[model samples]
Target: MLRIGLVGIGFMGRVHMLSFTDKPMIPNAYVKNGKLVAVCDIDSKKLEQAKKEIPSLEIFSDYKEMLASGKVDAVIIATPHYLHPLMGIEALKNKIPVLIEKPVGVFTKNVFELNEVASQNPDVVFGLLFNQRTNPFFVKAKEIIDNDGIGKLKRMNWMITNWYRPQKYYDNGSWRGTWAGEGGGVLMNQAPHQIDLWQWLCGMPTKVRAYCKFGKNRNVEVETDVTAYVEYPDGGSGVFVTSTHDAPGTNRLELIGNNGKIVIENEILSYKKLLVPENKLNETATANLMDPKNAPQFEEVIYTKKELGDIPWGVEHAITIENWINTIEGKEELIAPGIEGVKALELINSMLLSTFLDKEIELPIDSNKYYEELMKKCEKSEFKDTWRV
Candidate 1:
């Protein structure tokens, strides 16, 4: 059985703990080689409190102690956004795998650097908690998109704003808002999932044009609203609008193809699929597209939509964790591995860069240069992550 430790005792750390318990629940706790062996935090009171709940576990004020103790096989990092890269890099350097919370780093350069570090330590498995990728709805969306639900993808409209955060939510921590601290607002923190989905389902656009407003409707340092137009090759395109200030919020994704359009709202995937020709003999390309002998055919493919509505937070954590566990046991593949997450990170970073620079930025962004640029305007920040209840 692989023993594991968790660092950070904030809201996300607790969520990580809860997700570990949700696995099977056969023994009402983590098992199958995965156990919460140790925990660490600077706050003695908080660490002590956590120890009581997790009896038989060890606690430490310094994360280095936990690593040096060598009592576990892996670590889960649920610390603040800025600390992700540092902690993650430290753990990998120690030869311990890590399952870090979202937005891997404050900037994409950090993510790429982290990836390089992980590559140096192939014995360790670095992962991101991109739990949403495991959700049935999204998994199905990817499958359909890969199979071509829409003919020659034409347009996409994504209107997602159900992630409204109150000022108190930001005010709870002095470091919440500020270009230097939390690293941009909604897009970096709350919207990584949507951003990941945008990239996952539609892939990164060759070019992006955007307009963003920082604290226009709220008192946060980073942008609260954004509208962007993304241009892709294959004559396909998309328009994206995201915010954390909309009232009676909504999460909707609309994809239009030459044949049909698909809408995913209310967590339900409703579609008007265009048909494709049946009985085509081509193996690789649609027989009609590849050969004149096989003219383009038209037949609609229906997806048996799963019953999904109002998904709970961290719903897919268990799936991600279980996959990691299985991978360690040589039973399956890693879920949301670190390298793939870098792609998601770049997409988000570019969106922010485009909005900030008022110009399009290409994919696989230069994180080091971007970080340098970010520092020029951001000078410094104040969010040290108090881990508000």
Candidate 2:
């Protein structure tokens, strides 16, 4: 049986714990042979509270101590964004299978370092907590795109603002919205899923020009609102707008291509398949200005239970975790490997860099320059923290 220890007992950490222990009761909590053996956190009170809930649960204050103790066969790193790569590297170096929580790291350089270590330990199981990869709607979108369902993408737009965080939410934790602690705002924390899904379904854009508003709605040091314009290599363009202030916000993705257009929002996918490809129409039509003679056909896709709107959050997480455990046992492949995480991080870094330079930034951003700029913000941050333990 795989003995799993979870590092960090914060919000996400607790969610992981619930997925492990509350078996039949928890959504998507199905693994052949694994047990929740230990948990680690810096706060002793939190550890004590955890022990009270699970009397047999082993607790440690330091992750290093827990790793060296040999009580766990695998470790789940659910700590802060900055600590993800660092903690994951330590687990990999210890020859322990690791499943790290998302965004990989705050920056690409750190993730590269962790990836280097992961490369050397090729046999060790390394999975990322990109649970949204399990969503059915996204899965169908990827399948359609890969199969040329949209045929030569021309435009993409995603307006995701469901991330509504009030000032009290940020004030509740020391590391909530600071540059030093959580990295960026909506892009880093709330929108990583959408960003990852964006690239997963539509492919990464070559250039990004972003306008980010820091603390525009909340009293935080990082950006709470952002709108970015991206250009693709195939003459495709995209607009991504996200914020944490908009209540009754929208989560919509629209992808237009030569063959048709796809719209996904609020648990529904509306696909518009043109009878004649837009490119074909443009080439064959003789009229000075004209629409396609044959009207476009539209259909609402009925998602299987596995699709986006159907899967519960806890179930999706459990499904990803099960894939990780099965991968470690050589019974199955990982749903989301640790390496693919770099794409999202690259996008995040590029957006921030574009915002800082007030110009369009290209893909594969200058990691060193971004790191230098990020450190400058961290150095000048005026956020007061009386909540760290």
Candidate 3:
């Protein structure tokens, strides 16, 4: 069996630990070939609690000690945002496979450096916990796009604001909503999955112009609301809007292409396929501007939650963990490679940088410039008791 060591026995750490057991909290989904052999954390109380939960499990106060003890074949990092790349680098240097939680690092520079180390250790199974990738609807959307069901993307819009967090949620942890602690607000915390899926399905934008509201109706120092306009390489454009304060919030994604349009909202996928490509109609149409003959012919198909059987809540998290363990055992490939984590980081960093500089930021952003800006915020940040690796 694959021996898995988990770092940072916090909320997400506990969630990952659940998946390693035969009887996971999420029924019918567990890592069959792996077990949580060791756990490391700074909190003695959490370590004691973990020991109580798994009496046979080894516990450590220092992660480096755990990595050096040779008790675990792999490590899963569930630490804070800033420590992700640092711990990942340490694990890679120790030649241990690692699965990291999302938004790989606070900024692109650190993530790029982590990717560099990951590239050097090509044989290591480095993965990221982007659990939303396991959703059947998203997988099906990817299939349709890859098969040219939606030809030549023209526009994309995703307004995902369903991740509503109350003030008490932020107040629960010292490192919850501060810039020095958790990095950005909704983009870094709540919307990284959607941003990943956005770029995963529609591709990255070449330029981004964003407007953000920092501490908007929230007692935090980071952005709570954001609206960004992006331009693609093919002259295509897109918009992304997200927030953590919108109640009765919306989760919608619309993709318009040359041959069809796809709308995913309310756990349903609505696809409209045109009989003739829009460009073809534009070029060959002989009818008058308002003629009925010029009307477009199309077919619509709707896919609902009923199409996909009962998926227990939070099961995808276990599924992602299983995929990582399988990849380590050479049974399958990684679904969310650690290197791809940088794309979403770059996109979010660009959005914040755009809001910071009040201008449109281009792709392949100046990482040094962004780092400098982030450091300025860090220097002024009030949350100084942030976790360190």
Candidate 4:
């Protein structure tokens, strides 16, 4: 069996642990050749609680000790945002297979360093817990886009505000909304999945100009609301907007191309396929007074993928874990490789950098300069309860 170790016993760690159990949420998933052999957390009380829930489970207060004891064949780093890269690099250097949690890291420089260590250990498997990649709707979207179904993208817009968090949520954790701790607000936590999906489906933009509001409605130092405009190299453009304060929030993505359009919202994927490509009609139109307004009508198809379950987060995460196990056994390929984690991080940093400098930021950003800017913010960080535990 693939003896797996899980680091971090907080919210995500608990969610990861449940996927390994006989929970009904993941009825279709199980690690056939692997099991959770050990768990590590800095919080002793959390470790104690974990032992109560998992009687036969091994526990560790220090991750390094667990790594050195050779108790686990692989590990899942589910710690906070800042710990992903640090713990990932340590696990990779030890020649241990690792599946790191999202955004890879708060910044590109650190994630790049972790990736360098992973590259050095080619045999060791590396994956990221970008579980949303397993969602059928997103999978279908990627297939359609890759097949040129949308043909020469012109514009894309995604306004995802379903991530609503109250002041109490941030008040409970001192590190929740600070630059020195969580790195960012909505972009880092609530929107990593959307950000990753954005690049995964639409590709990274060439430049980004963003406006962000810090502590807009919440009592936090990082951005709680953001609106960003992006440009692609092929002249295509996009608009992204998100907020944690909008109730009855919206989660919609619309993609327009020369041939057709796609709109995904409320777990449904709809497409409008053009009979004659727009560009072709634009060039060969016979009428001088009017544009080509006639095109074959297409029906809207709803894609529920009921087999994937109604609650996507838990189900998709379970699928990701199963895929990771099979990949380690040479049975399948990873849907979300850890290295691709940098793409979303770059997008996050770019948007935030644009907000900080009040101008458009270019892609493949200057990592050192961003890091320098971040450290300056870190120095002046004024979060009162900055996570002493």
Candidate 5:
């Protein structure tokens, strides 16, 4: 079996465990194909708790020692957002495949460095836990776009409000609100899935203009609310909106394309393709590719929709775990490998920098410049209730 080691027993760390057990998000191979050999955390209490949950596990307080022991064939890093790249680098240095949790890192530079380490160690597989990639709804959406059903996407919009966080939640951990610790507020934590979706479905926008409110929802330093505008090279445009403050949450996606319109609400997807432009359809029953206003109606094709459950750490994390295992075995390509991590990291950093600059940030941002700036912010900042244990 593919032996695995997991580090960080916080919310995400537990999430990684649950993610592996539930096969919906991750492929069954990860569960049946591998084994969870060890669990690690810096907090002794947390380590003890993890043992209670998984009594048979080989528990450790030192991840470095765990790595050196070579008991596990791969590693999963679910530490805080900032620790991802650092832990990932260490994992790769040991020639071990690593599946790191999202945001990849607080800044682009860290992600790039981690990627460099990944490239050098091709023998070792590296993946980010962008599990939403494995969701059926999103998978269906990608298929539609690939088949050109949307037909040269003209515009798209997302209003995701179900993600709500309270002040107490941030207060629970001193590192929760700080830029140095968590990296960002909603953008990094609550909305990375949306970010990955927006950029993934429509392609990374050439331009990203965003406006955000800092400490808006609670007494923390980060954006709780954000609305971003994006522009694609082919004149395709999309809007990404998110908030951790709204109540009676509303989640929706609206897409308008040359051939049709698509909407996904409450996980029920629907779409209609107009065959004729209204300007011409008034005179004759004709379909227009340029402007299909009267296209034949088409209802959204329902893929065997799975009830959205408690969103796991993400969909691909476990599958990525398996990919790491297979990569080690020379069995297959990494499911959600390193380059994808870089892209996801780039999108997240661009949005944060957009808020800071009060301007639209360009794609393919200068990661090196941002890393230095982020480091400066981290060095001077103080953590409120940072974990001392």
Candidate 6:
């Protein structure tokens, strides 16, 4: 059995721990050939609670000690946003397989460093917990896209404002909305999964121009609302609008391509496949806009959750964790490799950088410049390290 060590007993940490248990917190979500052998957290109260929940569990106050103790064959870092890369780097250097929670790091620079270390430690499995990748709707969307069902993507738009958070939520944790602690508001915290999925399905954009509102309808220092415009390499453009302020919010993704259109909303995937390519129709139409021949025919298909079976919340996290363990055992390849985590991070940083500079920022942004700006925000953050414990 793979002995796993988990760091950070925060909300996500606790959830991850449940996956390795004999009975998972979520239905049909238990892992095989792995068990959480040890847990590390700086919070004494949290550790005490964990010890009570897990009998005969090895606990540590320092993650480095946990890594060096030889009690765990692998480690999972579910710490704060900024600590992800740092902890991942340490684990990789120790030649321990690691699975890190999302957003990789606050900035691409640090994540790049982590990626470099992971590259050097080729044998060690480096996985990322991008659980939403396992969602059937998204999985189907990817399959359709890869199969050229939506030939030559022309445009994409995601209005994912369903991540509503109240002021009390941010107020509960000192690090929740701060630059030094959480790194970003919606982009870093609530929307990383969708942002990762955006790139995963639609591919990375070449340029990004964004408008962000900090503390909009919320008392957070980081952006709570954002509207970003992006340009793909093929001259295609897309828009990403997100906020934690919308109530009964909207979660819709629409993609328009040369051959068809795809939409995912309310857990349903809708595809309108055109009988003739739009470009071809545009070039060969026999009549004016009112002509019957000019009107394109579409074969629409809708995929629903009922057809796919109801996937319980938090089950995807367990699936990802199990995939990580399987990868470590050479039983399966990782669904979300840790290195690909950088793409989503780059998108997050680019959108924030665009808003910061009030211009369209290019992909593979100047990491140094973004880091410099991020540090400025970190320097001004009022959050104290003591508050974390």
lDDT of 4 at 325: 84
lDDT of 2 at 260: 72
Task: Give lDDT tens digits, candidate 1, residues 2-98.
Answer: 7878888887777666455544322232333477778888878878777777777889888878887989788888877878888888999998888
Candidates' C-alpha lDDT: 0.74, 0.85, 0.89, 0.85, 0.74, 0.90
Q: What is the C-alpha RMSD of each candidate to the true structure, in Å?
A: 6.0, 2.8, 1.7, 2.6, 4.5, 1.9
> Quick one: how many clashes does candidate 2 have?
3
146-169: candidate 2 lDDT, tens digit per residue: 888888999999999989998899
Model 5, 273-387: lDDT tens digits are: 6655323345444345456654454554543355433334444456556666677678886556666766766777787778777778899987776776566666665773342
Give the least accurate 10-residue stretch of model 1, judged by summed lDDT.
23-32
Off by over 4 Å in 5: 18-30, 276-332, 384-389
Tens-digit per-residue lDDT, 114-199, candidate 4: 88998888888999989889887888888889999889889999999988999999988777889887888999998999899999
What TM-score would candidate 6 get against the native?
Answer: 0.96
Q: How many angstroms is residue 281 displaced in model 1 relative to the true structure, after the best TM-score fit?
A: 20
For candidate 1, the clash count comes to 12
C-alpha positional error of residue 286 in candidate 6 after TM-score superposition, expressed in Å: 6.5
TM-scores, all models, native as reference: 0.86, 0.92, 0.96, 0.93, 0.85, 0.96
Writing each residue's lDDT as its tens digit, candidate 6 over 259-335 gives: 98899998898999999777767655655667876678789998999766566678888888988999999999999
> In model 3, which residue pairs have backbone atoms overlapping below 3 Å?
none
For residue 295, give model 2's deviation from the true position in Å: 4.9
Q: Which portions of model 2 miss their true places by more than 4 Å?
A: 23-32, 282-309, 383-389
Better of 2 and 6 by lDDT: 6
